[model samples]
Target: MPSPMVSIINVSKRFGALQALDEVSLEIPRGAVQCIIGPSGSGKSTLLRCINQLEPTDSGAIFLEDELLGFERKGDKLLELSEGQIAGQRMKTGTVFQRFNLFQHMTARENIVEGPLRVLNRPRGEVMDEAVALLERVGLADKSGAYPAELSGGQQQRVAIARALAMRPKLLLFDEPTSALDPELVGEVLAVMHDLASTGMTMIVVTHELAFARDAASNVVFMDRGRIVEQGLPTTILTEPTEQRTRDFIGAER
Candidate 1:
């Protein structure tokens, strides 16, 4: 078997009295799509945040490829990296949030190229071309000149996806990418993601879309109450879940 591209080892996190993640461990391979599915407040989003280091883990470790994320081992201690260092590490992973966090004033093309120009310091001409290509990839080439307010919810989210791709991340994290979309617009967004999966883009998606998981995911993870209750091949987890909680969740959704 190939080595994992991302690993979470004994990861636990807390916010006040709530344990957002409890000793969760997962290995995500390169060129694989892993979908995390569960009810609300099940720590699905928290886990994604931890992977991107948006949420500092209370214990355990996360690794991307061979490198530790967010912290550095020094002698016998694990010390948090400086803000600058963390930013450098975070550049390898791109996250699309539940809310389409696009800049209201910037056009789609500008939003897509902002990161490369500001953080990577690439030539504007080069970044702009790549940005346009990314917009095209997300099926929004004609909407490149539109600002956030000028686009539909689905269109804005597609632009957000394009902005993340502009970074050329090794791993892409999607947190309920279509949750805010109109029912009619959801398919277009999922189609783009399905296309990405088909092209072997390594992705970890937190979604309620079982059809997407069933058809696109290489693995399905069923999480509840900040812990993984059951996980396996999508066919098994979605069709023949071993745990009652998984069955209940799927049953309720259906």
Candidate 2:
């Protein structure tokens, strides 16, 4: 059997007195879209952070394509990787934040090409061509020369999505990606995401957009108090969840 794209085994994280994640375990298959939904402070975003190694787990382990993340096993000991190594691993997963975090001074094209050019050291012409294609993929080909400040909220967020794609990441992590946009603008960003989903990109989205969850996600996970309350097919979990916590949360979302 092919290995799962991402595996979280008994992972836990703490922030002082607050437990951000508690023995969370999940397996995400390749080319699957998993939507994580819950109330605020439920550790949905924290889980994404841990998966990307932006935040460390206090216990347990996370693996991408069967390779341990953030550490290497040597004999009986597990050694943490160097910063450079960690950065390399992180490049495999791309994250889009709630707020569009594009570089203010850079044009959309520049933002998309920066990582491929500077970090991966790819050929300049190749990266530029890919950047143009990525911008077109996100429905912003004409906006490539525009700076973030000159674009609408949805356009900037689309640029952010293109930037993430430019790296050709194995997985995409979206944390409340449309939360900062106006209601009218939200559909544009979600539309782009829907297209990505159709292409079988592995994505884990932390979002309150239940419609997207219902339509785009292969599975839906509901979390509360740093623990997974329930997880199953989106049709089941979103419509007929067995757990009271899951039902309550889904009820509140609508």
Candidate 3:
């Protein structure tokens, strides 16, 4: 098999008394839609955060393509990347939160273009062109002129997706993409994600929807209490889980 696009080796993170992650290791190949399902606070979210370096890992190494997301360096080490360097690396992996994090002050188009213009330092005409195309892809072509306040929750989140896509990220990280939507509006947001997945996009999704996991995911990772208890093909993990913890968790949800 070819090498994984992202490699997480011996990763661990702790906060005071709590050990959020414990010697976690995962390999995510390119263009794979991996769904991480677990009870809340089971380290699923923390593992995602660690992959993008959103949360610092006390001991671990994460590799993303040519650069290392987190490198071990200390104790007379010649050089280690500074915080700003790590933040820049983190930006390459776009994140969509449970809450649509669109800026209230900017219009939809503006919000989509903000990161590219400021972070990537692309030319205005080029960035605007890319943003408009992305907005259209996410079904928000007509809403570009509207501000966050003008759009509904679903529309806003779609815009948020466009904003993340506008960066042309190598990987998309979604933390409960549809959790904030109204029950009636969740379908629209999920539809957009399904469309993205169809195009073979590399994505890591944290979701509670079992059907989405079984149908949409290329693989399912079942996590519990700061460790990955089980991971396998969706069919295997969902229907033939080996670990009691994985089966019990899925059983309770059903």
Judge candidate 3 at residue 172 and give its lDDT: 92
What ranges in model 2 sit over 4 Å off?
A: none
TM-scores of the candidates in the order shown: 0.98, 0.98, 0.94
Q: How close is candidate 1 to the true structure, as a TM-score?
A: 0.98
Clash pairs (backbone) in predicted model 3: none
Across 181-220, the per-residue lDDT of candidate 2 in tens digits comes to: 8999999999999999999999999999999999999999
| Candidate 3 Cα misplacement greater than 4 A, ranges | 72-80
User: What's the CA error at residue 111 for candidate 3, in Å?
Assistant: 0.7
Worst 10 residues of 1 by lDDT: 1-10
Taken over the whole model, the C-alpha lDDT of each candidate is 0.94, 0.94, 0.87
Please write out the lDDT profile of model 1 over residues 1-254, one tens digit for every residue.
Answer: 76688999999999999999999999999998999999999999999999999989999999999999999999988999999999999999989988989999899999999999999999999998898789889988899899999999999989998898899999999999998889999999999899989988899999999999999999999999999999999999999999999999999998
Q: Compare candidates 1 and 3 on lDDT and give the better one.
A: 1
C-alpha positional error of residue 147 in candidate 2 after TM-score superposition, expressed in Å: 0.9
User: Cα deviation of 24 in candidate 3 (Å)?
Assistant: 0.8
Mind sharing the TM-score for model 2? Answer: 0.98
